[model samples]
Structure formats: structure tokens, C-alpha cells
Target chain A: MIEVIRSGLFTTIQDLGRFGFRSTGVPVSGPMDQTSAAFANELLQNDPNDPLIEMAYVGATFLFNKSATIAFAGAICEVKLNNEIVRDRSVLKIEAGSVISFGAMKEGNFLYLAILGGFKTDKLLGSACYYEAVNGMARMSKGMRLSFQADHQQREINLNRKVIGLNRNNGIIEVEKGPEFHLLSEEDAQVLTQTQFTISPQSNRMGILLNELVEIESKEIISSPVQAGTVQLTKGGQLIVLMRDAQTVGGYPRVLQLTEKSINQLVQTRFNMDFRFELARESA
Target chain B: MDNPTVRKYGSKAILIEWEAVISPEINDQVVKTAQFLQENHSDGILEVVNSYHSLLCFLKEKADLASYIDICRCLTIPISELNRTRQIWQVPTCYDTSFGSDLVSISNAKQLSIEEIVKLHSTGIFRIYGMGFLPGFLYLGGLNKQIHMPRKQVVKQAVPKGSVAIGGEQTGIYPQSSPGGWNIIGRTPIDLFNAELERPTPFSVGDSIQFVPISIEEYAQIETAAKNGRYQLKSVHND
Candidate 1:
């Protein structure tokens, strides 16, 4: 068992996502940064889809009541285990009564923490991903005790294995022309590709809002299907990139769609950071 | 109806879009296409979400986009041959000012008496065009033109669950409390969705719904019965 000493800004347990329920208007709520969440699970030899703690902007302080193998990935932060500094992207063995605390995020906006054998959380609609409507809880609160499988076997530590660092890229987001992309005039399309847009503070798991607005004729489509990474143009010309927790259907015209990799990269970008959209070569 | 144009939505999903209009004819095609794809392509397809004029197919894993497009193009199910058994749900609603906070304002805006507004709302049988925005939130079409109103200029920070509201040509119930912009006129006591059940929502797309207005006292009774899992929603089969 692990006790949450102090719950951070926003934290939840997420797996790959909820599937087979989109027809019922269920959002595929999952990790904002899929690559990093999978990396944390991979380091601990757990299933890539195993449920892990996803922290945004800040992280929690956890007190382990039993021995466990764990890993931390995504975002650069000052993490300490029992007053000793620890590094991410590597497996760490925790003893009973060990306390791990995180502080002062240096880079990135999200983090993932994975434990061996995964956390024992109730799976709704065949997914362990936390969705407020389905699961009845949005985020972990202080003093919550999370159950996990106890590690009893003695394992050898591989000190010789080299850790591969995450590939951080420049703020260039790749996108494809959406179904309504043809509705944009040539000048509007040029502005979308040429201008640098900053991430707005109003952004959340539902969608990422941009600081800059483009000039485009606003028209409402018959409510149609939308998904994660779908860039919707509002009637007021605001661009909102639908994230994992966005609604399944929307009425706004879909202008562009971010690539899967680009979705993962964009979530890690902090608010106010400028990024330019580059149309994919194949799409162009 | 013409064939839907299949296009790539993202790396892992494909969009099959029909005519860019909202009508029963277009919605029927969208529903039929979604049903056909789910039944035939269960191996690679994860889920098929159908809206008014489109179907979004989520793939289990990335596959050849061209081939999937080909499969979608080959769907030749005739509308007549596809028989869909739909359910017509009778939702118990109360249009009192206590539950519907905007009832008086909507009555004043539409220049209709509160009784007239309730009468118009409950008389029409609405068709469920889509279910989205919130889980179990049914987007129903065929609202009475007399009571049709524009969405609120400023959205309410939080609209109560079971608030039956109208926006443009549509009317729907808020399955859960959420931020909304619709003009609230009534409230339902029955629970529309329960995640713990095998079937989350009682109704689906292509289903029909009709509001049965009840008194505020009946609303209290039904709400209690629903909370205790003693009330069964009244529904009928549309043959």
C-alpha cells in the first residue's frame, strides 16, 4: 500500500485508455503523454498499458508501506527518495517505509510514475483509466491509500545498462488536413501554417487552446464525430486541439489533426510556449 | 443516398462522412454504416461512433489507410434491407421553476405561457440523432418550432443533471451536471446512464424519446424511487 502524503495539483491513475465505448459517448481518457507513460512502465518490466500515476504541473509525495519496484518518466523534476536524489528513466527498488517526494518541476508539464505489477484500481468499461463521469473520482486527494502488488522476490540490479534519454524536439507540431480543411481560404491556410501560436493558460485535458487566433469564416457543421488531436476552429476563430478527454462529438469545423506523436509532444509543452504547425509532407 | 466519403481523421482513426446536413435520411445512412462496420470489421476496428452525418471508426492498431477506405467504400447495405429495431422511451419530466431554473425566462422569450411551452415540449416525439458532449447526453432532433430558442449568450457555469433544455432545433437532457448554454425548460427524474450496468445508456442513436410531464410532487416520488433503483423507465418498441 502507498499513502498519498500530499496530492499535487492534478493526479490520476491512467492506463492505455477506455475503448469499445465511444459509441456511448465515452471519451478515451488516458495519459496526456503516452510515450512517457509507456516508458515508465517499460522500465519497471510492467505491461505498457498498466495503470500509472499521471501528474500534471506538480507531483505527489508517496509513502510506501511495502517493498516495490518503481520508475519515473516524463518531465524533469527534483525527486528524492529517503533524502537521496533519484533519476528518471531507470528502475528503482523501494523498501518498506520509504518516502518519495517530488519538487520544483524544471521542464515539461506532465509526469508519469509506474510501479511493478501495476496499481490495483477498479476497471470501468474494461479500462483502468480515470474518468470523472465513469469512475466518480477525477484526481487523487491527500491521504488516499493506493493498493499495489508487493514485491517479495529478490532481483538483481543491472548497473551496467545504459539509460537512453528522452528525445526532446523543437516546438514544431506536425499536422494533417482535416475533413473541413478545404473550407479554409488560401490566405487562412497560409496564416495557420505561418504564424506561431502560444499555448493558452485556459488549456486542460479536454482541449489545448492557443493564444493566437486565425482569420477564417466561422460556420457550424452538423454535429459530427471528433477525437483526440482533432483541431477544431470555433466560430470566433479560436483554435482548440481536442485532447484525450474531449467530447466524442462537436459542432465546430475541424480544420486540422495533429499527428499521434505530435499529440504526445504537445501535452508536454508548458503554457505560453510558442509552437508552429508544419503540414505533413504526405498530407501536403 | 450517396456513398460516404472515407478520410483519415488521424493516425489511428478514419472518418466516414455523409452529406453535410442534419436529417433523418442522412442519420439513417450514418447509423447503417456504423452498424455494418462494427459487425463486419470486428477484428481491427475498436469502436464506431456515429453522429448526425458521419461515423468515426477507431482502429485497434494502425493499418493500411487505403485498404480501410476501400472497405468503407464497398459497404453496399441498402436502407430497406437494414431493419433496425428502435425503442421509444417515455421520459418523465417536470417543468416546474424549481428544477428548471430558466423556465420563466424561456417562457417570456418565446412569448408563450408556461403551460403552452410544456404542452409543445411534451407533445412531440423526438428522434435521437446522436449521443455526445457528455456521457449519455442524447442529442434529440424534431423540437417543436414554436418553442425553438437560441442557446444562451453566456453559458451557465454548471447546469444541473437531468435538466431538459432546448437549443436551436434540438432538445436534450443533461445526463450529468455540466457547463451548458441551452435554455432549460424541464427536468427528468429517471437516470439516463449507469456505468456499472452492462449497458451504460438505456437508449441509443436512432431511438425515439417523448417527454411525459409530471407534477412537482410526482417528481419527488420518482426521484426517490430512481435513487433506490426501484423505478423502471417506461419504454415501448417501435415496430
Candidate 2:
């Protein structure tokens, strides 16, 4: 078992996501950075869908009740075991009674910490992902205890893998035309590709707000199904990139949809960072 | 009408748009398409989400978009052959002053007596256009013109669950407590959404709902039964 000494900004237990429930209006809540989350599990040779702690901005401090093998990935953060700083993307061994803490977040918006056999949490709606108060606890609070599988205890395991040769974090985010893309004025459409927009501070799991205002000529469509990576042009001319936890239906005019790879990169985009959007298929 | 315009939404999904307008016929077509896809799902298909006039198909991997487009273009919806059976639910609502905090203000705006407003609302049978945004929050259509009112100028930070509200031409019940701009006129005792149940929502898209007015005492009794998981929501089959 692990006890939370001090919870960070927004820490929650997440898995691959809550699936097969969107039909009933449930938002799919998962790790903001999918590649990073998967990396942590891959190091331990565990199921990628196993539950792990997802932290926004920075991580938390925890007390390990038993010796466990763990891994950390995403966001160049300072993770320390006791007073000694540990490395990222490598299997870590923590002794019983050891206090593990993550210090200042250097870059990116999310981080994932995974145990060897995954956290033992209640499987609600076929997933261990924590959503709002309806299914389970929303976020980690101080004095929270998380149990893990005790049987799969490996003493000495060497992992020499690292997240190498991936440049998805920075660059132009690729997107495709949405259902209502044709409704935008020619000039407004051109501006979307020509101009750069800053990521607003008012971003959450639901969506990321862009600083620039878009000039859309079309009105709101009827409330329709919207998914993660959908780029919506609001009535106030603001552009919002819906995240994993976004509502299933919305009324805003969808102008573009970020590719799956772009969404993975989007979660790492920090606030006030300026980025441009490029068509996924330039010919199309 | 011509077949739906199928276009790739992203690398993992495709959008099939049947119409730009909202009507029962359009919604039925969308539902039919969703059902057809579900029955004939290819290995790469993940899930199909149905909305008012379009269906979003999420795929596991990249499939032959050209072949899928051909399938969509040649596909024909046999309206008569489709299963038209639908469930009509009589949802109980309490319009008492204690439950309906915005009743007086809505009454003043519409210039109708509170009892008259409730009567008109109860008599009208509402159609479910969509079931989304929030869990079990039904997007309903069909409201009495007399009771049609704009949403609250100031949105409520938290409206209680089962709050029956009206926002312009739309009237719906808040399945769970949530921030809303709609004007609450009544409250229901039944739980529109319960995670424990295999089927979380009692109502689905394309279903019809009728509000039945009950007194405060009856509301309490039904609320208790609902909490105990013994409330049998009054429903009937409609073809």
C-alpha cells in the first residue's frame, strides 16, 4: 500500500480509459499523455491498461508501505526517493517505509507513475479510471491510501529501454477538416493554417483553449456527438480543442479534428506556448 | 433523399451526416444507421455514436475508406422493415413550490398561472432527440408554446438532480446535479442515472417521455422506493 503525504495539483488514478460508456453520456477519462502512460507500464512488462497515477503539472509525495518496483514517465519532472533524485523512464525499486516525491515540473502538463502489477482499485464500469464523484473519487487527496498487487514482486529486473527518436511533443499539430469545416469563410479558414495560437491557461481535461480568436461565419450546429481531438469554433470566436474528458455532445461548430498523434502531442503543450495547425493530409 | 455524406472525421473515426436539420425522421435514420453498423461491425470498427442527424464511427485502426464510402453510398434504409417499437415512460414530477424554485419567475414571465403551466407541460408528450451531454440527460423536444421561455440569464452553479427544466424550445430533466442555464419548473423523484444498473439510463434515444404530476407526499414515497431500487418506472410499448 502507498499513502499520499501531499497530493499535487490534480492527481487521479487512470487506465487506458472508460470505454463502451459514451453511449450513455459518460466522458472517457484517461491519462492526458497516452504515450507516456504506456511507457511506464512497458518498462515493468505490465498490461498497458493497468491503473496508474496521473498527475497534472507536478506529481505528489507518497509513503510506500511495502517494497515495490515502479516507473515514471512524461514531463521532465524531478522525482526523488527520500532525498536522492531518481531518473525517468527506468524501472525504480523503492524500499519499505521509503518516501517518494516528485519535485518541480520543468516542462509539459502531465506525468504518469506506474507500479509493477498496477494499483488495486475498484473496477467501475469496466475500467479503473477515476472520473467524477459518480463512479469514484475525483482526485487524490491528502492521507489517501492506494493498494497494489503484492504477489508480482520482482526483486531484480533490468530495463534498458528509453523513449527515443520521438518528436511528437513539439511542432505543428496536424488536423483534418471537421464536419462543418466548409462553413468557415475563406479568409477565416486561411487564418487557421497561417496564424499561430497560444495555449490559454484556462485549460483542463475537458479541453484546451487557444489564445487567438477565430472569425467563423457559420452558426452553431445542433447538439451533436463530439470526440477528443475535435476542434470547435465557439460563438465568441474562440477555438477549443476537446480533450479526452470532454462531453460527448456539443453545439459549437466543429472546424477541425486533430489526428490521434496530434492529440498525444497536444497534452504535452504547456500554457502560453504558441503553436500552429497543419492539415494532416496536405493534398486533401 | 440521397445517401448520407460519409467523410473521414479523423484517422480513427468517420462521420456520416444524413441531414442538417433536426426532426424525428432524421433521428430515426441516424438510429437505423447506427443499428445497422453495430450488427455488421467490421473488425476494425470500435464504436458507433448516434446523434440527432449524424453518426460518429470510431475505428480501431485505419480501414479502407474508399470501400467503406462505397458501402455507405449503396446502403438503403428500409423504414418499414425497421423495428419501430419504442418505449414510452411516464416520469413522475413534483411541481410544488418547494421543489420548483423558478416556478414563480417562469409563471410571471409567461403570464400563466402555475397550475396552468404544469397542466400544459404534463399533457404534452415529449420526444427524445438525443441522450447525451450529461449521463441520462435526455435532449427532449415538443413543448407547449405557452410555456416556452428562454434560459436563465445567470446560469445556476448547481441544479439538483431530476430537476425538470426548460430552455427556450428545449425541455429536459437533469439526470444528475450539474451547472445549467435552464429554468427549473419541477423535480422528479426517480434516478435517471444509476451506475450500479447494467443499463444506467432507463430512457434511450428515440424513446418518448410524458411527465405525470404528483403531490409532495407521493413524491417522497416514490423517492424512497427509488432509493431502495424497487421503483418500477411506469412504462409502455408503442409501435
Candidate 3:
């Protein structure tokens, strides 16, 4: 068990997320930056799917009740264990009652902390992830006891493993045209595929309401079930790119949808960064 | 022979849509393409999601889309066979004044009595066009034009779970409480979503539904029974 001495901005518990019920309108609420989560798991050498603690913007200070091996990755979080500044994205073995603290990222929005054998929590839909705001603090809170495997003595975090390799690159995300792409005018379509758009201030885990270059209209498409990758054109013609926690159904015309991998990347993006769309055409 | 509209969806998906002013021909083509792709090309396809008039066939980025389109164009499922496989269903609702929050609003909007509104709604069998928006929020077609009503200008902050409602020419159930603009006319106690349960969704696409009106007292009885997990909805099928 780890004790939270301080709670930062917004942190929460997350795993890979609940799937298989998307057609039923349930959002796959998972970690915003899956790369971070996966990297933390790799550091601890835990099963890739094992549930971990997901922190956001700012992080927390934890006092380990017992000795354990843990690793950190994701955002550029400054970590300190027992008042000694520790390395980011590496595994460590700490003594019982040792304190671990982390600070806000200089450039990112989310982070991940992984432990060996994963965190223990009541299973919701076969996943240990807390969902739909995880009752809100974004993650763990002050004085909260986070249950995890502390029995393990030590583990190795490969210093060789690279973080922010291919996935975290910002500015351009790959997308496929949605079913109703033809509904947009030629200029709007051209602009949508070519012009660089900025992520609007009104963006979060739910979706990114982007500012597109040209004017467009939101005609009612055949009402259907939408998924997280859906990018909808609002009545005012701005684009709203659905994210991990987006609603399941929508009526607006979906102009384009990000690739599943891109959606994972978008979850970790720093706010207000200008991003452009890159058309990824699968060759015949 | 009907011309089917073939369009590319991203690099991974291709949508084959049939143009139809009326009838279920387009829907049939969509489902047929879905089945053919499912059975014949599962290796190349990642997922096949069906809409009202088109099927979204997801593919691997490296695969050949031109060949995939050609394959879909050549695929065929007999119209009668497709209809035979389609499932029609009935969903019951009681539009009592207490449960139906928008009963008065809808009644006034259409310049009719609550009794008339209920009669018009219950008189027609609705077609299940799709399932989305929220878990189990069914989008039903075939509404009686007499009770046609628009959605609320401002979405209610909290529409209760199981609110049977109407918007424009469509009627639906609010599977779970989320922000919605539909004019609710009744409430059902059955939960359409439960993260704790397996098989969370109650309905699927291509199903039909019917509305059965009940009184406030009867609504309470059924709602209580459903809450206690003892209620069972009755359904009739066509041969």
C-alpha cells in the first residue's frame, strides 16, 4: 500500500479500458497517454495489460507502507524518492516508509506510474480501472491508500528503452476519411486534409473541439453509433475530434476520424498546441 | 439492377452504400455486404460496422482497398434471405403524465390531448434504425406523423434513466442518464447499461419495436418489478 501525502491537480486510476460494449454507447475511458502507461509497465516488467496509476498535469507524493519495486514514465514528471531526486522513466526499489514525490510537467498533461504485478482494485467490467471520472480526483487523492504489489523486492527498468519514440510527436495526426466525407464541399474537404488546425481551448479527455480553416455545415448524417476516433463537424462547421471518453452516439456529420493509434497519442497531447491532419491512405 | 455507392473511409475502411428513396433495399445491401465481408474477408478486415444504408469495412493499412471494393461489389445476398435474417422486436412504454415529463409539452405542441398523443404513439409499430448516442439508446423510425415533435431547445441537464421520448420523426429510450434534448414522454425502470454486467446492451441493430401504454399506477408496478429484477417484457414475432 502507498499513502498519498499530497494530491496534485487531477489524477486518477486507469487501465487499458472497457471495450466490447461500444455499439451500446459506452465510452472506452482509459489512460489519456497509453504510451506512458505501457512504458511504465515495461519499466517494471509487469504484464502490459496490468492496471496502473494514471496521473495528470500535476502528480502526487506517496509514502510506501512497505518496500516495493516501481517505475515511472509518460510525461516529463520530476520524481524524488526519500528526498533524493530520482530519474524519470526508470524502476526503483525503495525502503518501507520512503516518500516519493512528483511535480508538474513542463510540457505535458498526463503521466503513468507502474508497479510489478500491477495495482489491485475491485474489477469493473473485467478491468481494474476506475471509470467515468473515477469518482473525480482524476486519480488518487490525499491520504488515499493505493493498493499494489509491494511484496516484490526489486525489478530492472531498461535504461535502453526509449520514451517518446514514434507516438508522442505532436502537430500532425494521421486520420482516415469518415463515411460522410463527401458531404463536405470540395474546398472544405481540401482544407480539412491540407490545412494545419489548432486545438481549441475547449478540449479535454472527452474530445478536442478544433478550429478548422474553411467554413462547413453540420447536416444530419444517417444517425449511427459513433466511436472515440470520430471527428464531427458542428453546426458552426468547427471540427470536434472525439477522444477516449467521448459519447457513443452523435448526429453531426463526421468528416474524418483519427486512427486508433492516433487517438491514443492525442490523449497525451499538451493543450493549445497547433496540430495538423495527415491523410494516411492505405495503398492498394 | 441497382447502383451501389462505393466510397473510401480513411485508408482502412471502405463504405458500400446503395441509394434508396424508400424501402429496406439499402439496409439489406448494407447487411449483405457486412455478412459477406465477415465470412469471406475476416483476415483483411479489422471490424465491420453497419449503418442504415452502408457498411463500414475496416482493413489493414497495407492491404489492397481496390480489390476489397471489387470483392464487395461482386458480393450478393438475396433480398428475401436478408429479410429472413432480420430481427423485429417490440418495446413497451407507458406514457403516463408522471413518468412522461414532456407529455404536456408534446400534447400542446401538436395541439392534441395527452390521450390522443398516447394513442397516436402506441398505434404505430416503430422500426429500429440504429442503436447509439448512449448505451442502448435506440433510434426508432416509423413514428405516427400526428405526434411529431421537435427536441427541447436546451438539453435537460439530467434526463432520468429509461425515459421514453420523441424528437422530430423519431422515438427512443434514454438508456442511461446523460445530457439530452429529446422531449421525454415516459420512463422505463429497466437499466440499459451496467458496467458491472456482461452483455450490457439489450438491443441490436435491425430490430423492430412496439409501444404499449400503461397508467401511472401500472407504471409504478412494472418499474418496481423491473428494479427488483423480476419483470419480463413480452414480444411477438412475425413468421
Against the native chain B, each candidate's TM-score is 0.93, 0.93, 0.85
Each model's interface RMSD (Å)?
0.7, 1.4, 3.8
RMSD of each: 1.8, 2.0, 3.8
Worst 10 residues of 2 chain A by lDDT: A160-169
Worst 10 residues of 2 chain B by lDDT: B72-81
* C-alpha lDDT score of every prediction, in listed order: 0.86, 0.83, 0.71
lDDT of 3 by residue, A125-210 (tens): 55666545222223566888878865654555564444453356468788877767767778877778777677665777778777
Candidate 3: which pairs clash?
Answer: A11-A138, A11-A139, A12-A138, A12-A139, A24-B135, A176-B10, A177-B10, A249-B133, B89-B208, B100-B185
Which lDDT tens digits does candidate 2 get at residues B1-239?
Answer: 54688877766677898778888888888888877776776565677778788888777656776677666667776656478688889999999989888899988998999999999999988888777788777888889888999988899999999999999988999988889999998999999988777778888778899999999999999999999988999988878
- Candidate 3: segments with Cα more than 4 A from true spot: A3-10, A61-63, A82-84, A87-89, A124-126, A133-146, A153-170, A193-196, A211-213, A281-284, B1-16, B20-23, B32-47, B57-74, B78-90
TM-score of 2: 0.95
Two-chain DockQ for each candidate model:
0.87, 0.70, 0.35
For model 3, the local distance difference test gives 0.71
What number of backbone clashes does candidate 3 have, counting pairs of residues 3 or more apart or in separate chains?
10
Per-candidate TM-score against the hidden true structure: 0.96, 0.95, 0.85
Give the fraction of native contacts in model 1.
0.88
Shift in Å, residue B114, candidate 1: 1.0
Candidate 1 residue lDDT tens string, B50-161: 9888899988785666788778878788656478888899999999988878779888887899999999999999889998888898889898899888999999998988
Q: How would you encode candidate 1's per-residue C-alpha lDDT over A109-219 as one tens digit per residue?
A: 888888888999999988888888888978999999999977854555342333344445487999999889999889989988998988887988899999898888779
